[model samples]
Target: MMAGSGRDESGAGGVDDAVRELLLLMPRMVGRVKRIPVPEALQSQSLAPRHLSLLSCLLFDGPMSVNELAARLEVAPTTVSLMVADLSAKGILDRRADPADRRRRIVAIVPERHDAIAAWLAPGAAAWRRVLTPLAPAQRRLFVDTLRAYEAAVAEERREE
Candidate 1:
């Protein structure tokens, strides 16, 4: 049956059409994002894709403690600590004792590395901003929720396999 013809034995083609389009579009989108080159300054950092989320959280929200970051990133505190330690060792991040809470350390991108990290991350952020700009608050929320659901569904499927 034609996917987008809006008619089929299933009563409607909308869902199937959307799925077909996304299945085709996702790989192309991933490939293009992958092609975005790592900036020269960060080339030797050996950063992984997971590092992007950590960096984005810091860049947008300012310095935060490992527990705060772990909460935001939905990862274990130990996981965030390990990443922070690795980045700190690479000179990409700095950790300082919080004045209000000396026992807690705040993690931030090194001042010298901020521009490079921003430059590397700017394109993706800008693209998302542009895409989401026209969406109403509800629509944007729905879009984000949909992506989260898809992620959970994929993880569940993978676990079952």
Candidate 2:
């Protein structure tokens, strides 16, 4: 289902054409946007989006064992272990033996870098704020929900590939 105007037959065709245009332009637009400077603090950190995603997940959800993080990320436990170890070496994350289970390792962000990461993210955050500010509350909710749908669709496509 398309957002904005795909709810009824009268608007379905128009929304379809608009969606086609959007899909055609998105990759080109993203290619340019990807060049935006990483926040200076993150400039040399070499953190990919997925890496930061792991950090964000840890930060927001609190420390978790590697297998749990892998499940949350829909990736292999070994992949999570490697990524966590790398981040730990970089001093941006820490991994400790889970107190309740000696065999489990809990991973968490370093705490100090959260602010720095937020600073680096401010530009994109501000841009999103500016774009959403003019929308009505319900419209903003719809936009967010639609964007999540798109994100899921892209993730599913990647998984298939």
Candidate 3:
């Protein structure tokens, strides 16, 4: 494939074309996501980009202990604990003793705030569903793996510099 032109040996657009398209599309995608305003119920709460994944995990996967959240988030349990504490204090999240294991605390979005949180995050999730729904399972895996590989490569390059 021509590096900049994105044309393959058969003159069919190939890998280069995909890369070029992604490069252009990613920023616009991010901008559109960033412009998804926080719902009125959540506007006064102290939230940030870091909370998105944590909340997304709970929203999509249901409640779990801080350690479970840390593992899913790829962060230290202490970090998740701090975020849980902060969100709980803000009344955006709730912490309750896990029924199955009282020693463990399960973290979740406060029941009353669930709708607002879901409403705030639903658009992006819906957009992803629309794009990925037509793909076969393996194709979806490939797409997700490709993005992860790209992210790893970028991080590796940054670290070397």
Q: Write the per-residue lDDT of candidate 3 for residues 1-161, one digit (tens) a residue.
A: 55455445433365666677889999998899889999998999968989999999999999998999999998999999999999999998999999988998899888999999999999999999999999999999999998889989999989999
lDDT of 2 by residue, 98-152 (tens): 8998887788877788777666556666788899999999999999799889989
The TM-score measured for candidate 3 stands at 0.89
Query: Runs in model 1 with CA error above 4 Å?
Result: 1-13
Reference-based TM-score of each model = 0.92, 0.64, 0.89
Write down the lDDT that model 2 would get: 0.80
Q: What is the lDDT of residue 156 in candidate 1?
A: 100
Instruction: Quote the positional error of residue 131 for candidate 3 in Å.
Output: 1.2
lDDT of 3 at 47: 82
Relative to the true structure, candidate 1 has a C-alpha RMSD (angstroms) of 3.3
Report every candidate's CA lDDT: 0.93, 0.80, 0.90
Q: Give the residue spans of candidate 2 off by over 4 A.
A: 1-15, 28-36, 122-161
Residue-pair clash count for candidate 1: 0
Q: Is candidate 2 or candidate 3 better by TM-score?
A: 3
Instruction: Give residue 22's lDDT in candidate 2 (0 to 100).
Output: 84
